[model samples]
Target: MKISELFYSIQGEGKRAGMPSFFIRTNYCNLRCMFKSGNLCDTSYTSWHPDDDKNLGETSIESISDKYREFLCKDIVITGGEPTMYADELLLLCKKLKKVNKDSFITIETNGTFIGEFINYTDLISLSPKLKSSVPFDTPQKKMHDKSRINLKVLRKYNSLYKAGKLNIQWKFVFTSGEDIKEIKSLQSEIRFKNENVFLMPEGVSEKDLKKTRPETVKACLENNYNYTDRLHILIWGNKRGV
Candidate 1:
């Protein structure tokens, strides 16, 4: 698999929040999104703009899975840049991780732009569809990202999987303003995902920004019946990587 970084950390969001988990952040992204606040997507290092410092490269599934054995965590989170970008490799990698710990809860964090059969074997699928708030300021990139980011077909596929008892799913959305609630409501009407499975997270890359935005996010979640989750890693270790 083409991995950016693999490490163990407490899961910072979703149904598995607070659980000690292994994080496999894969390299490359289909969309070039940055927060409206000008903070680049938190995983930019794992995105199309690869960080020279990390120097992400390919490694065998057995090698990466061995790290999980070392960490001894029960949950494995395969996140991105966008994991579905490497669906074939991920399928092979997940199978190896399962060999290491069959009981492990394997979670995949996705942008919901790509639908893959690989998701069938996962324990949890956290779908974060890019919102208008994620559109970048650069004109051409913004146009491209806006054009390709939200794929209703993929979302419906995930919704169908959940309703059919084939998938355990969470629809995660990032928000910066109370106005964003209207956007979520509109999407909820379309997908009809379980309300509790819809998680609303504030758009922030640092502890201070996250704390500042928490109050309004709490109100929005309360009124909308959406689960509110903060990025615990930021609170515990700022926005530094390799946690």
Candidate 2:
């Protein structure tokens, strides 16, 4: 796999927030996310400029599993850049993790642009479909990012899998403003996913910024009957990497 950083830390976002877990952050992303607040993607080293980390190189799936075994953690989160970009390797990694311990929970966080066999091995799919607000203005990637950010067909497949009990899924959206709710509603209407599975998170990497957006976020969640998730990692460690 094209690996970036591996660490044992608490699950920082979505349904498993605060749970002790191991992280396998894959390098390279399909999208370059620049939020409406003018903050570049929080983990830009893995996306916007992957080479920023000279040590960002390949590692075997065996080594990844060994590290998880060392932690003996109940959960392992495979995040990105875009973990789904390495679909076959991700499948192998998930298989190895299950082989090590069948009961260990596995979560794969992705931008929802790719769907693959790896979904079968994962316990939960943390699917964050990027909103238009994530498009970086005036960048060469803006067109590509805007065009590739959302895939309704892929989203529908995930929803169908969840409906058939093949795997669990959470539809998480990073909101920049209440106007973002319109896009979310439109997607939910087309996807026909259950509202309960929807999670709304404010777009911020700082505690203060998150605090600034919390009220509107909470209100939006309440109004739409969606769940609210805070970036616990950000609150606990500012915007630093490796939790």
Q: Pick the candidate with the highest lDDT.
A: 2
Give the clashing pairs for model 1. Answer: none
- Model 2 per-residue lDDT tens digits across residues 97-213: 999998889999998999999998899999999998899998899999999999999999999999999979998999888779999999988999888999999889899999999
| Candidate 2, position 17, lDDT | 97
How well does candidate 2 score on lDDT at residue 58? 87
Give the per-residue Cα lDDT of candidate 2 at 35. Answer: 83
The worst-scoring run of ten residues by lDDT in candidate 2 lies at 47-56
> For all candidates, what are the clash counts?
0, 0
Cα lDDT of candidate 2 equals 0.90
- For residue 119, model 2's alpha carbon misses the true position, in angstroms, by 1.2
State which candidate has the highest TM-score: 2
Q: What is the per-residue lDDT of model 1 for residues 1-243, given as tens digits with 9 covering 90 to 100?
A: 677898888999877889999988888789987876788888888764788567467877888887788887889999978989888888888778887788988999999988777886699989999888888886578888999988988899999989999999998888788767887777788988778888989889998889878888888989989999989998899888887
lDDT minimum window of 10 residues, candidate 1: 47-56
